[model samples]
Target chain A: MAYRSTPLRIDRDHALRERILECALSRVADGGFAALTMQALAEDVGIATGSLYRHFRSKGELAADVFASASQREVDALGAALRGPGDPAQRLAAGVHQFAARAWHSRRLAFALIAEPVDPEVDEQRLLYREAYAELFSELLEEGRKAGVFQLHSPSLIAACLVGAIAEALVGPLSPPARAAREAGYPAPALDDVSQGLVLFCLRAVGVKELV
Target chain B: MAYRSTPLRIDRDHALRERILECALSRVADGGFAALTMQALAEDVGIATGSLYRHFRSKGELAADVFASASQREVDALGAALRGPGDPAQRLAAGVHQFAARAWHSRRLAFALIAEPVDPEVDEQRLLYREAYAELFSELLEEGRKAGVFQLHSPSLIAACLVGAIAEALVGPLSPPARAAREAGYPAPALDDVSQGLVLFCLRAVGVKELV
Candidate 1:
């Protein structure tokens, strides 16, 4: 009976932790990391603040977790697209389009993940995730180079450039100030414009023969 | 007499602040922001920590100032190269080459300024400095487009991509682990390799006619 109850307790704890992370992520998506207070997240998860601390020792740790989880999803999605179909160049273009489109649709979360000035812990995660993105691009670039479809030197370095360009390209339009300006009727680049620009920038960067 | 002394006092205070920032920058250059503790900075400046506090309210504020001053120098150097004599395409290549060369020379400081996990204040400065870099590129991009030497859409967006690409490309080769590997005789891309790769990436990204 004791062994059975121990497993049940472990299951309950795991579920609660997952729920807390989900709520924390939701808060961040809605209002960036600034909105993710312990008290608010606890209430959102129907838990006590003390209990929240029991799960996450500090806001930084929790924020880092959220950042990693969210970033992992993006990496996974981009990896799938880049590895999915068509030629390597087409796959690269599809990956960029999917990334920009997803980022545009969730402007706040994207901005938060990409450029929001937050805890150093989250920033650490950012560096790791940027590397993750570079890895995915490097794989595709190697494939393209081998196929003679992409003319490039140092595929790893080129991959890093692609990661940087794509992230920086999206940071502006998704930023809060830009969001406010758009809401106030100022001119801003639409998703299609950003997506198209990024795709061109990346394809040309990798030395796609046709684009060049 | 009071007014005259007031001016002298203000001059002395300003000089001390500059000295403090110099020391702080040196610390960051040697060991990244992790070595930029307020107490260590005070000792470096031969002043009391309390006196340092009089100059900067907090460590974050001090780090931001250091970040700004260092970033401003890079921005100024880059601006000169980008706005210097030659066609827009030539200037663009020269700028990328110069920027990469400078970062390679000051690997630690460049890493700190470019992608360090530091206080939120420093992160804010990073975002602002990135915009400054983008503005310089945007100006040249517009010039290139008008001169019919470069074919691109959305100079602003393309400029951001260039900024991102250049920063990201250098971050890898300049990072601490990369530095350690290089020092230990690991095969890492040399400065020329990175600079040339980055220049090619940027030129192609902006649609330089010859490169294409």
Candidate 2:
């Protein structure tokens, strides 16, 4: 009976861990990584601070976990868009458009994930997730090249450029200062304009046949 | 006599501070930021660790200063290349090639500056320097667009994309693991190839015609 109960206890621990991650992710989505204090997260999780420590050793460790989970979601979303139904160029445009729209909607979280100054651990995750994004773009780029829809010798290098271009393009408009400036009625590019400019820049860079 | 002595003491302190920063930059360039420690840096300067703290309150502060100084040199160099004698397209290509070549020659330092996971203070500096780079590109992009040599609606946004693309493209090739893989006989993109591909990409993206 004790042995059987051990399985149930492990299940309970796993469920509790999942709950903690969900709460932590929400905190980051709302206020960037700065708001993800272990003490506050413990209160949100309805667990003691000591219990939180039991699950994650340090704030850096916990933040890295949170960063990975959030970034993975983004990677998955981007993957779906890139692999969706269309020609290579169309898919690329759709993916870039979807990515920009999503980031525009969640400006704070997107800024946090893309360019926020945070723990080194999160920065490590940034590099990993960037590689993941590049891989997805690599697949589409190679396909585009083979289909004669794109003209590029090195797909991998160009994919990395796309990842960087997209991130850098969104970072400015989504940043807090930019958002504040917009709130104060300062002129700023709208989401459509940014998305279109990025699509054009990427499509042109890849040597697409014609620009629509 | 006291007043006169004060100026001498101030001069000595300033000279010592400059020496400390130069030593710190060398340490970072040689081994990335991981090799930068207060004790080791003090030893390199032939001073006590306590004296090092008198100049820099913390490792992060020292690291950030080194980062800013090193990055400023790159920015200045790229600026000279971009603002040099050429048409918009020629200048852009020249700047890209020069930037890539400089980074290739100093892979480790370039990697550290571009993508190493380090202190938040340094990360903050990264954002600032990236802005500096983007601003430089903005000037050129706007010039190109006005000259009808490049076609782009938003100079600033496209400038950010170019900055991101250049940094991202180099980050992969310049990363430590990639370096090790190349050293171990794995195939890697040559600097010339990268420079040519990057120049072509930038030129095409900006609507530069008749690629020579």
Cα lDDT of model 2 by residue, A1-212, tens digit: 35464788899989999999999999999998889999999999998999998889899889999989988988999999999998999999999999999999988889999999999999999999999999999999999999999999999999999999999989899988999999999998899999999999999999997875
Q: Give per-residue CA lDDT, model 2, range B1-212, as digits (tens).
A: 45564788999999999999999999988999999999999999999999999889999999999999999999999999999998989999999999999999999899999999999999999999999999999999999889999988999999999999999999999999999999999998899999999999999888778774
**TM-scores for every candidate against the unseen true structure:** 0.96, 0.97
lDDT measured at residue B106 in model 1 versus the true structure, 0 to 100? 94
lDDT of 1 by residue, B93-120 (tens): 9999999999989999999999989999
Poorest 10 consecutive residues of model 1 chain B by lDDT? B1-10
Q: Which window of ten consecutive residues has the lowest lDDT sum in model 1 chain A?
A: A1-10
lDDT of 2 at B97: 99
lDDT of each structure?
0.93, 0.94
lDDT of 1 at B54: 89
Interface DockQ of candidate 2: 0.85
Question: After superposition, which runs of candidate 1 have C-alpha atoms over 4 Å from their true positions?
Answer: A1-5, B1-5
Poorly placed runs, candidate 2 (over 4 Å): A1-5, B1-5
Docking model 1 quality class: high
